[model samples]
Target: MAIDDAISFKKLEVFLAFMKLNNMARVSELLGVSTVSVHRSLHSLEEAMRCPLFKREGRSLIPLQAAYTFAEFAQRAVEECEHGILKVRETAGFNAKRLKIGSLYSLTLRCIPQLMIGLKLRKPVLDIDLTLGSNRDLLQQLADGKLDAIVIGVHTKSEFHDALDPELLSIPLFDDDIFLAAPLNSPYSGQTQINLTDLHQEKFVTLADGFVTSQDFWYCFEKAGFSPNISMRVQDIFSLINLVSGGIGYSLLPGRVAKFSSQIELIPLESNYGAQQRITLLLPKIRERDPNLLALTAECRMYGRHDGKKDGFL
Candidate 1:
């Protein structure tokens, strides 16, 4: 016989709860509904199935043998539906136990670690897979669905802003000033601030073309109206930092990297050539409600709120 229109997955859930609890009040409590609602659900489920699944004794419902037999099929149906839903979500890269995060290598010094710790506290079971790359690379990966979320720096006047997808959501975390990275014993180290024009003739080691720092590097120099004497270009921020620390050359870097190495000092740039790297958390808008992304965004918001009170550029 065909099932009645009253039969639904929700009603089956209520029926299963009633079959297991056997007490309408307890079922109501378990399902967070009124006892009357639970009783009505069971009665409707019985009517829909055209079966006396329960024998009513006053206000209590005693499961008949048919109820027990049917429960096996109902439980299987529920379990299979749940599994199917999980599979669909997994395929869509939603509600997965693993969270794929992309970030700039520079953020690993403090920002990424702090965010990860807080995220772990919120979702202990979530496995975070981190991929570090330049801003351009990370953004591309995120757009291609290779990464679920990314933490990257975007300059105020940058073309990177235009590269952002309309479908992506951006959460601003904090702004980090671009600084002239100098070795500890460099001639400019003791200065309060350095003008970009003064660094026009200075040899510099910069990250390659795709990094946000590289863009900032070029932009500042363009403002200075002269090309820097680029001594070397590296693929990663750490390498650029090492090159600068080892006295290879000066580089324009984010102030956040100040704490990454003791041998390197970040000197403020002249205002005319200064730029602020806006550290932002970006995720697909479609998955904004995903639990892992929600946790990450919460941590990012907390970080942004408490950012100014912190001493260093974090």
Candidate 2:
């Protein structure tokens, strides 16, 4: 007879428990069954194995030599089955050892890479999956449980308070000042400070509507008391920077993006339009204590603290 068809793993579990505990009442309590049920299960296991598993001695069940040998196989089989299940879960991403992080495409230039380096130093064996997209997309994925955590830019304020979902937790990473990215040869590029109104007649390239920087890009023109003649809208910040480099148009972005290219000049704007944007780490409040997330969060916080004092915004 085939073992799978003849023997029940459940009955074997009871047999194992009884063999170790040596008490029908204790085995039943441990398995959440009655003494009668435990006795029946042990008998069933013995019948399936085609061997006597126990010998009775003064109302007590004593294991036979056969019982010890069978138990060794049974324990190994049970443990292997459990390990198989865990492996399947990990492959399906249900229970995973890898950490999933989400962020804006821009941060991959600096902040994201730095954080990953710091995280690896502390958790050498930890694997990380970094997903980059718009702030809107990242936040939605985080809410749907598709991402472990997110790093994105928030509106900066002196008080450093961020308005977010109550179920989410955020840690401020760093503050980055907003600047205008212009073609290296543009007249504005030579200026130490470019007034927003100076770009009234200039066409601009920008990220699409869903991006946080896109909104902030427009808001600068609005605050400057004029509307930008938007020439093109793209999906990624790097592409937008490339467009500016080709003299396609000027664009507004956070200071962190300035390091990505030498073809464009990152010019500071006047106070009326110059505002610092806050970079923050966002994760579900429920998972705040998860070991990987906690370690990543700590590394991010430390990176921000140290980098802010040096180059500013890691």
Candidate 3:
């Protein structure tokens, strides 16, 4: 016979409790419901099944052979449903103990570490796996579900670049200005502002093409109507900084990296060629409500509010 709409998983649960305890008051106490509610659920279950599964006797329920048989199936159904829920959650990375995060290598100097510490405080048991790469690589990994979240830089004026995926959600952390990175002893180091066109003859070091800084480098130079004399291209920001600091060449970098090394000087670019990098946190919209991601988002927002005032990175 087909089951009635009143035969729900909740009713099955109440039925199982009643079968186990054999007393209405006990089942009510265990399920945190009124005894009257428990009795109503059991009555509904019997009506839906079109079979009497219990023998009622003065505020007590006595199980018959049919009740015991039905209880076995009910328990299995509940267990299987619970297992399915667990598998679904695991597939979605929901409530997982580990959080896999991706980020730009440049942010490791300041932004990433501070966020990590705050995230740990908020979720003490959560294990964080960090992957550092260029902005393009990180964004791709996040889109593919290889990483849970990412911290990267994007153009401030056009926050959503053409390459950015619309399916992802972004949180603005802070706005950082791009500067001309030069060796401490360079002649232009004494200048407060340097025009990009004037540096056309100067050899420069830069991060590889996939990095946001590399895009910024090309954009500023293109606006200046001259391509830079690039002497070296590196994959990571730290290496590019080392090359610029060692008098190898000049490069364009964000102001947040200013505290990384005193050997390099950051000079503002001419207003017409100036660019700003907005450091942002991105996550998949599908997993935005996950507990771990929620905590991480909160930490990022807190950091964005205080990091500017505390570190003067903005």
Candidate 4:
């Protein structure tokens, strides 16, 4: 059979399943078919590709190098198909304009809401589905096609340049300064300057692991040459502020969050430990030309441009 005629969607699906599970029985179980059916599909796929995808050894079938490479393409193809199906269904049955977005929980306060509103004004019929999580989670969702774009904080240093996936396209939004949050009545609240070492004995509150703030909080301790005495770990920035307001423990946060509460005081660090966090909009390069995503990118850039000019960061 010619390559075009031999390859079927089900065959590719079975090929991907075999690559992942590496067991005919398991692939069959996952595909809701008999093992014999899965075996036939695998044979059909290998023949269509005209390449050795596996090496049989005893009762085990070890995948060849080409199999790994093919699996990557297969996964992408499957995801794109699913994406197309979803778009079609949303347009046909729902008759509702839809765009899926993910963001760091912190941006919900100012950045995300503004972007969504801007997009809505440009496309009044558009409906946005927003998912809020940590930087890592949002990025994962974007790469998985669960989100069209993500707003997150990237370190302005090495991490900004090196940590992201090469295939992801990013747009820098603004620069935010990191600050320490303390109770309004705390002694540190009245201080002209404070070092992390000065608060060595004082308990601290922190965002739980996986958040960008959590990493920055630890980075401060590393810079101050001491370990933080963390008293609590919360899921969101608001909760961290509430804890500080109630005299639970002091915490470090980006400047944007300081406006959320007047009960807490923000203290600027005296040393170079006050690193700037870069707020960024990230999307998959593959979806760069998507119409809905293009509109979103335009709004984000327009907002960034205007905000940057207003703030003198452009």
Candidate 2, superposed: residue stretches over 4 Å from native: 1-95, 157-162, 309-314
lDDT of 4: 0.81
Question: Candidate 1: lDDT of 210?
Answer: 88
Tens digit of per-residue lDDT, candidate 3, span 1-314 = 66689999999999988777777789889999999999899998998888888787776677889989999999999999999998898887887989999988778877899999999999999999999998878878887888999998888765446556778888988888889999987989689789888877889888888888898888888899988887889998788889988999999998878888888989999899988888889998888899999999999999999884444344
lDDT of 4 by residue, 70-109 (tens): 9999899999998998888565323347888888877776
Q: Write the per-residue lDDT of candidate 2 for residues 74-171, one digit (tens) a residue.
A: 99999999999878756544435788899988888667888999888878888899999998899899988789899988777534344567798888
Better of 1 and 4 by lDDT: 1
Lowest lDDT block of 10, candidate 2: 305-314
Error of 4 at 298 (Å): 1.1
Q: Whose TM-score is greatest here?
A: 3
User: TM-score of the candidate numbered 3?
Assistant: 0.82
Cα lDDT computed for each candidate against the true fold: 0.86, 0.83, 0.86, 0.81
Which RMSD values do the candidates have, in order?
4.4, 7.3, 3.4, 15.2
Please report, as a residue range, the 10-residue window in candidate 4 with the lowest summed lDDT.
305-314
Q: With candidate 4 superimposed using the best TM-score fit, by how many Å does residue 150's alpha carbon deviate from the native?
A: 0.6
Residues 1-314 of candidate 1 have per-residue lDDT tens digits of: 77778988898899898888778888888889998898788888888888799887887788999999988999999999999998998977787889999998888877888899999999999999999998888988998989999998888764757767889899988888888999998988688778888766789899899888898889888888998888898998888889999999999988878777898988888898888788899999999998789999999999888852252454
Supply candidate 1's per-residue lDDT for 206.
91
